[model samples]
Target chain A: MMGSLSGRYAIVGVGTSRFGKLQGVSTMGFTLEAAKQAIEDAGLSRDQVDGVLVMMPAIMGEQHGWAARVAAYLGVEPTFSATMDLGGATACGSVQTAMAAIDAGYCHTVLCCFATQNWPQGVAMQLFGSEFQVPYGDVGAICLMAHIKRRQQYDYGYPDELYGQIAVTWRQHAQLNPEAQMRKPMSLDDYMRSRWVAEPLRLFDCCPNTDGGGACIVTSAERARDLAKPVVRILGAGQSHSSEIIHPRGAEQRSLGGTKAATMAFGMAGLTPSDLDVAQIYDAFTPRVVHDLVAYGICASEEVPEFVTRGNLTFAGRLPSNTAGGLLSEGHLSGFGHIREGVRQIRGECGDRQVADAQVCLVTGYGGAPHEAPPTVSYSALILAR
Target chain B: MFAIEKPLPRANEDTAPYWAAAHKGELRLQRCDDCGHVRFPPSALCPRCLSQHHEWVKLSGRATVFSWIVVHQSQHPAFNGDTPYNVTIVELEEGPRMHTHIVDCPNDQIRIGMPVEVVFDRVNDEVTLPKFRPAKSK
Candidate 1:
């Protein structure tokens, strides 16, 4: 359909540093740890990685020249080295970039890596909001999302518990993930009683700010078969960025612009939503999970409340989602963790949370709310196949 | 007792006139002279027509609450004492929207599409911010 690059490259290996509060490690330290693990997981030496793309160093207070520095630290001297800044979308953003580079013969193997220090001194709020937003009290992502949730409630009478259901489901998924940061079992009661971060948005409704890093290696599909791990080809990838300005008065202001990207990905892969064996979606906030699911056409817009109500989000359910507990519980590596989990699912390595007979996985990254008032401008989606 | 050091907006050339009008108790927006399209968060050129020519026009700050969020917790130091305050998206009558607070109305009574009008509140010595309150019936 579109000038297709389907099945051009595959994700050979994925890695993550311990996700919780790793107090003493610097950003570079975490990046190096994840990169080393990824290289080993791919069964390739450090010298074999000729391309490196560092994503969002600013989230961890790291300085500029990140790719070159990471390259130097790993002692690889990659032929292609740069940074990709797409806010929370950087994970899938990096995968799409690596796929294109490999197809063009720019580099053989590319390592995409990222690390963040878990909302150190409100860094997450500061990184996304602006002077205009702050002065007027559009403080954090919580408030921004709360506004959208309230709008949806106004339009559709969606109950407040709908978001709680998402939080509850992800917490269940987290219970099975040893690497997840917030694995404590939560009931609807816990979700209901949680303190309000923003009105209509309780504490549990927001993702825990996590300190960690995640990395994945991408190379040509042909080379991936020869590597150590089972191959997971990146079948299709698409990204779209719309309005940076948040139109406060517009209709349905929650538009993340992800539909464009998701549609393109489905077209490029020649696949439909029904083909997805599992979905690893970005959940920076719980409402985002609902919004993205609708955007991806996995469920009808009006059916979201009933859809999530059916408990179909668990690993054993009709539509397994965020099997790694997502940023809400899996720890926030931006969206990098989502990509890593997609690879794991395709490889059937998720021991406790593995979906049965999984073959195709859909992963998405949505972020870049430039001002607290705007809809998310950046969206990326990738289809990974075993 | 508590004090709030409200964050002041830094106005540049693109936004200086808008802020200046707010200081004078008028809500003004930039209208493209060539295209007749109004704009907010003032910019150098008309987004639709790409016309650099524009005029600053004042509008009746009458608006309705399009949507709102009650902030129970804030990361900013200035708002720590003001928990449970509302940040509203008000659609102005002239067809622009602004992020402003609704005053003189209880949190429970605020509703979408409720009419409101602007009231200037001085935040600092040099800056005056525009806030809104429930409008009386005609």
Candidate 2:
């Protein structure tokens, strides 16, 4: 079924609202702006959008029927519409959901979007594991990711310098991206000096809080060829979720569902990790890049520290990654910015940061159950080809 | 000013027994009668065998540090006074890992595979949290 769906759908257009702090915009306001821009980018009328999928940020508080609300606000009456919440995985998951919907003939030309205004409310409080974790001060993604990084250190002998290297490289890419938030040049010395948010995770290891939104239009590959921008084909899409929580005896603490999802995606696309020209890894924290690198079969687990240190993620390297700075330097639009960058990279639209002759771009979405109640239980992967 | 400031675990039907045992200075978990599987955070059915029949069994209060983190930053206002505390995941002898704090040990001294034993701390009238300390012997 997955194999048959490959190369059938494509992301024709992508757009985003302001990348950094915008004082006056509401969450829905950003969503509308991104959606409108995506419609314009595709050279399609707003009335032609018949399907809508939206992800409302948890930090902004939950609202019922957000997709319906977005559809109503955008003045589109669609045969298919729904809201999804898979934590950080929602953006890529939205694209996968739209592909499935289109394959099922439920609707065509789906607009998938997500935006958050994480101000005043501050960082999202750990809500799921409140009974087990809150009293112990095991709150927030920083602490959860710290636990994973610390375990990785114990199991794989990964050094803090390896994580810092990832931070430094992504910031370098951010400097080239005009839309990136933390564009200031960062050095390894600067990364080492940054304050620690958690013992194993420093301040620079985390993504910043920002108010932003991003949207992309998904339709048949044939339809995308008739659109305004270059056609970035969705060659493969795969998603995997686990019921395992962190406290269980057999819970997987070191890695996530990326391996299973990536396997399915690669299988559907009939490609291997060697075919990827560039990647947009979900870097809610730095170690996620390491996890995804191994999970996607890009390199052996033991080779990750060395692979990253060798400048493999730099623009001049074999496989450039997070070219738009990822969530680490791109400002957090969940993983939407990663998707947007993936599309742009495939289109050869990334001016200075573009990977030379980029063809296959891999974008991954990770994170669910914020505090590792089942750390990284949800994962989605998309294999895009030009 | 004397009120407890930290969040407390609220016991529902499946979890009340575990808390009751903790209040009595014992660590009890649900053990499946059919498959002999023990579970935490109390559930109705066994995750391994899907068996509904179970019993509350007291453990030896022994565990080993599976992983840990020293929180240099506080996420909640109540824990601001306790900045730089250690939150560790300890694997119980009965095979369930739990999220807890390690007492009587410096944050820097905690290591994976270090032996520890549970010690209950009664925070108030209704709750007693199970914390760990360095064990006298393996």
lDDT of 2 at A319: 91
Candidate 1 residue pairs that clash: A246-A374
Q: In DockQ terms, which candidate is top?
A: 2
How many backbone collisions does model 1 have?
1
Best by lDDT: 2
Q: List model 1 lDDT by residue over A120-199, tens digit each.
A: 55344333455456777777667677876777778778887898989899899989988889999999999999998877
Model 1 stretches with alpha carbons more than 4 Å out: A1-3, A60-62, A119-128, A248-256, A370-376, B1-4
lDDT values, one for every candidate: 0.82, 0.86
- Residue B99 error for model 1, in Å? 1.3
Listed in order, each prediction's TM-score against the native is 0.94, 0.96
